[model samples]
Target: MSSLDGTVAAPLSPPRPSSRLPRASDQDGSYPRPQMLRGAWADLDGTWSFRNTGDDPAWRTGFPDARDIVVPFPPESPASGIDEPGFHPVVWYARTITRAELDAAGYGGAAPRLLLHFGAVDHRARVWVDGQFIGEHEGGHTPFTLDVTEALGTDPDTAHTLVVRAEDDPHDVTQPRGKQDWHEHPHAIWYRRTTGIWQTVWLEAVPTASIAGLRWTNVDHATMRLTVRLSGERPAGARVRITARWHEGDEDLATVEAVVPVHAHEVEVVVPVARQQNGQAEDELVWSPETPRLVDAVVSLLPAEGPEPLDAVSSYFGVRTVGVDGGAFLLNGRAYDVRSVLNQGYWPESHLAAPSRQALRREVELIKELGFTAARNHQKIEDPRFLYWADRLGLLVWGEAPGAYAFSPLAVQRLVREWMDAVERDASHPSIVTWVPANESWGVQHVATDPAQQAYARSLADVTRALDPTRPVISNDGWEHTNSDIVTVHDYEGDGARLATTYADDAARTALLGGRGPADRRILVGGAVDEGQPVMLTEFGGVDFQPGAKREDGWGYTSAVDDDDWVARITALYDGVRASAFLAGSCWTQLTDTVQETNGLLNADRTPKVPIERIRAAVTGR
Candidate 1:
């Protein structure tokens, strides 16, 4: 069979030897809502009836004839057990639900509403319960939910059918398809396309009226603002009580509370938090990569005339502020240079989806071990579990959105709304200090010369700031900046000596803008560089192969013939970058080697290619 990208289909090949396989416990059945966790929930992963409908509408009525597929893994990935790879434009998934299962999940309680959550479904998804339509959602990266209590039928004696229909067209450049290749086979830069559910799916039971969402904004080290959004019916005189706990490694610091009336569906409240030991604010307790401190918070709604609180949820926040000063990134009122590595969040067997929560945490641990304070989640929005670990473990992150290749009305519509959704979904986290909407002119390529394209880029930056004022927004990541908080450029100049000269001073910045770098790459587009904004070499030093490593048909900016040569070249590049008089930060080419791209400091399986200590010394200059 030919794929949609005009290539013949073949059986899925085995991954590299370093690839990590999914464990028996890798179903990710844990609580989906890390920000707001509740007690009553059920994991909806495991085997399910799967059928490739391929744009056929007949599969919608009922899926009586379908084979088995493991939940959470797409058909393209080997972990899913169905490794046949031809484009599946439409697919159907079905599973059975029984009264006993509902009762075990606590959905049988009085006034309980059954909520079905899909961590993510590619492109577009339409859901149904017991042959009755429920709802549909667009955007492949964000989560969606449906209330299916009524759809489960009135009779509680019988079982029900849960069905989902997902549609995706990776070849459509108008949609926001990240590194997923539209080609028949994987090629340069772009890898495989993932359709259907690439993330977890589960069910949770909540009260008739519960807290639906939360958004946190750090006003300062002593103050934090929270916007709580409620769901379900709003009774008269409903009040919400918020309690925040400050703990210093099991030693309780203090506890504070705020009671606010919920007149409407959403209400905002300012909570004052102090890091005190002997009645004085301990400035050292503030959050930073060096010392990551978190404050746990619990929220409960109090009805006007009820004995117990209406609803309660568990969440946490960090007290920190991020801003930009003259040519320096500031963290907690001090200039802090960000030493980060570019991580694409890809695995050999799992592709976009991670095999387990441990895998995500291990990546963050490795980044910290390598002496990097932050990571640029290049081109991908990344798994929420990864962000959770970064927040818990104290690693900074630059949140990035995938870019569309072409510019059209549909492309604009797709990128803007989806970017906003992605930002909103991740805004609450303190680890994410910067938001990048476009990267290297992938979606808006004409921003340099075209006025309309420039306007769109500026509009995206404005939208990002409007939604999240606490963090800085990078309009377009690499060169051709329009209205960016940080002036970042990607220059893969392999020669360490010449690379140093390109960013030595403002004169070098001018000369490089006139096509002076390797491959005659243009550093600035339309001669646009805000003199007052902070400058960073967001990408550089893609030293390809290391010593004793078997040479495969791989690609990188430059190749090191031996281990000594690799060390010298990589160290020289870092030396040049750090020696720059104008550079406030630098992001290396990558953290791990992806499929065809072999420019990672670590192998695909998270193992270090070179000596960990040597790489750490070079990166941190310690």
Candidate 2:
């Protein structure tokens, strides 16, 4: 198939090796990774000796004599390499992927869409297939794909060697590294940095003429509409048939079918009430964070000549809505307040990668148990595991980016691109309600005023609109916030009333074009705090370490170095902060202690740092 961008699909110009089958060196204690992956399916994880450059550096030639670290996990992380010092910043990764699957899939299709899907490669990495120069990809946060359809040797049944070279310096502030500190090990709000293939790699097979993508309009039950987009060569009357199977549990439910003529890149297929369209019963389940019901769908293409499954992809969708009338936010046409905690998805064992699905679900379960409906993932693009559970477990979410504290046009471009991929890849979930670009102006200058930053933020807004416009996007989360659907504000120790002072200033100073969303955690500051504004107090209440105990410092208004006093003081302030109407909602500092900053509601081992009862009182106001 031709490239989606109109460029000729590049083939294996370089010769590939008829090499031996590739397999990971070590698999002991490695994550039970998923069987299947999207894009060019490849798994570049397993076991490799990890050593920082500061150690004896003699492993470049033959295998170094050292402890084994798991692949895909950064050397800085305990999960990767030996639990000792993390891998040297510049490290080499070795792994192999089965090419037989690619050869088998290409049996009947035009050709196998063998792509190397890297969830994320920190700093930068170069890729090789069977020692063939596949390509190189930069950017550590987003996912990227490479078409290596022709790179595999002629043999249809052999594993091809896949090599990746990763390098990252902790001090490089120009990248979109959320909270990694270079000089010292992660301390005081800073966590360890993960470099190289933090995400998954896989190969996916598709027909020459395949449905590139599809859009579900997630309306109400009776009026579910979907748009089908076919890529590649299409005849004038090329017929595309879509079969949608909606299910609740084991019980087989309803199935809807539609056929449309394929245009260049799109074809709008309206699915009206079954009765309204063809006098058939139209019954479909709705999805929300609460119920989080999912309806499954499989799109099949049948040519006008007869019946043939040109392309088929099994997908799921959720039906939900968000809006606001007066002051309250609404979900499913009802009032919903955004109560969230800053959730940074990090684990003691797997910095970003969750050991198992349960690890991911536990985070969501703990958040709900804390008596909150939502969580704002602090500053990083989270793994899909979190979303998978958020959709099933009923937790509203405010998705944030791995912050770009250092500003750059190139960095901004990569940020927006990766974010777009994240948005489109995860848009079908029901829990995600908000989108963000800039968080606290870490990498921005006069973001609210600077033309470039403004344009970048606006461009992100535009991209979000083009991709999924239903949700809202904050151009810049905090500083110089403008051009957003919601009035998102960020404040630290300010009281509710003092927090509301900004809105008062906005109301008093600038003309109100129209009311936007209650700005982030600071939706409405209120009376109280002669000392400060009646802050919504969105971010408060994180004392991971015991008070009076010396641990790593964290980045927040109040750091709880020790759990005893700091925890009590931090939790108490949150309790006091929530007592004002000036604040519409509040999300605590964070869900878990990411790396060294241990002031999470939960501990590094998924343990509750603070007793659940202590935190629930503040959330439920008991």
- Highest lDDT against the true fold, candidate: 1
Clashing pairs in 1: none
The candidate that achieves the highest TM-score relative to the unseen native structure:
1
* 1-622 per-residue lDDT for model 1 (tens digits): 1111112233222212102211111223255666776655677878988998544555554565678888888888787887756788888898887777677556855447888988888889999887788999888888888998888766778788888999888688877888888886788888887889988888877789878888889876567888999999997899876666566666556566667788999988787654332324445557789877777766777788553577776777877889998888999778998999999888877778887768888999999999999999987888777877788788999999888899999899988888888888888888999999998888876676888888888888899999998898888887777778887888898887877887898777656544534344444554455556778888888878744656576778898887678778888998888778778898998899888888899988888887898889878778
Q: Please, what are the lDDT tens digits per residue for candidate 2 over residues 1-622? A: 1211112222212111101111111111122221111122223456644444442223332234445667667766667644543435776665546545454334324434554567677877776666676788766776676766677756766776656667776667777788766655665566666776676665555566666666666554346556767766665567655444444455545555556666666777665434323323321355565566665544555554655455555455565766444444557656565778888877777676666556677888888888778888877777666776676677888777776666686677767766776676666567787777667666665564467765666667678867877776655554344455454445464343543443343242132222223232222112101222112334555544543345544444555544465545654565554444444456777777666665566766767765777767755666
Q: Name the runs in model 1 displaced over 4 angstroms.
A: 1-29, 53-58, 61-65, 274-282, 510-529, 546-552
Cα lDDT, model 2, residue 59: 30
C-alpha TM-scores of all predictions: 0.91, 0.77
- Give the local distance difference test score of model 2: 0.57
In model 1, the worst 10-residue window by lDDT is 17-26
Could you tell me the TM-score of candidate 1? 0.91
Please, what is the whole-model Cα lDDT of each candidate in the order they appear?
0.78, 0.57
